[model samples]
Target: MKNNIILSWIEEGVVSIPSFLFSEYKSIGLTDLECMLILQLHAFMEKGNSFPTLEELSNRMTLSLEQCSQTLGSLLTRGYLEILKGHTDQGIYFEKYSLQPLWKKLINHQLLVEKEQTEQQLKLEEGSLFTIFEQEFARPLSPMECETLAMWIDNDHHNPALIKAALQESVMSGKLNFRYIDRILFEWKKNGIQTVDQAKQQGKKFRSHQQKTKVEERKKGGTDTVPFYNWLES
Candidate 1:
């Protein structure tokens, strides 16, 4: 019966795994042997080897049976692997190894990596902003001015693109001052403008558009109004 099972697995063919498991994620935390053990466990599950033997696993690797046990023990202790009881389709309970802990660790590590990348990108953008401002103003920024520029991004949540647009507007208007650029940003904020393109389109609104309708009304004529009545005249 056992030989039949081994033959069945052989007939079932090779199991596929993501290359990243060994190429990238292995070096992050899992040791070489531990990574191999995980892959073997994965293969076992996929190939209907519900419970793979330590002897088989060790034979596949350079590790001895004792070393395999010790490694698995370490993995369990470190919360890298877990045992779970799950139901099959027929409602029969089966014990299986869970890789949930590994998945959770990988997810957290990726999130941290993404966050670090974003921070690095933001730093690069901030440096670029400093250089652009220096070139625009024809002088190095004062400490106080630099602090204000930092506040625009860090505290006010202004993205580099929006600030750059405002700078461009200042240059176009021949008023290359920080105050004018700040006011432009403030106006864009009030108008709920998210992109430079949106703000530019807003500047092209119809003269007879709703936004200008009130001013047009005033320019044309006033609405009808009753004459003021004196209280004592009645």
Candidate 2:
């Protein structure tokens, strides 16, 4: 019966995913093992709102005692469970493992720290206004793009002031990403734009050009219309 219960839990769904699980894991990633471990925790918790002992789980899963112990240790370290040591009715004491209830709270703290560091790094880069972007938007940035942004901010090659202005323009124009930033930098380099004003001017001109093209396209058939503008504009 004990083995049947364990198997039934596994068969029902080796993992009990909360409704918010996907959105939470989307930022990082979740693994099958992690999911299974959490489900096991849910099952054991049902007995008396306490974690199952290593021996009980081992016997139920038909795993060697050593394997069960190791598995529990790994699950605890990986943030899937938290082990609480306590005493039972008998004089012999034992430990219990259960899912942490305040996981979202913990995640918020980590995110806050990462955001602060990224903003400070951006500020130190080329003294560009692009650092303000950190305050306005929070998106998953790739490691490579993050490094590039850091380098750009550390050096003055990208003109911090112009970068900041361009970033604002991009945000207003519904464009954000390293690719867009790189394109702005390339255009600035070509036009020898040194001040924020130059960048803003170019941005205004680009907007005007876009508006004209959109108006022209409306005059023509919106669909099946192709213009010989730059790749980005197209």
lDDT of 1 by residue, 157-206 (tens): 88788888878766755668777778777777877988878866754452
Q: Give Cα-based local distance difference scores for all models.
A: 0.77, 0.63
Estimate, for each residue in 60-161, the C-alpha lDDT of model 2 and write its tens digit.
Answer: 665677877777677566665677787778867976655673365347756886899987885566443434655545754557866776676566467666
Q: Pick the candidate with the highest TM-score.
A: 1
Give the local distance difference test score of model 2.
0.63
Worst 10 residues of 1 by lDDT: 225-234
Q: After TM-score superposition, what is the CA distance of residue 117 in candidate 2 from its true location, in Å?
A: 24
Candidate RMSDs in Å, in order, are 9.8, 14.7
Best by lDDT: 1
Residue-level error in angstroms, candidate 2, position 155: 5.3
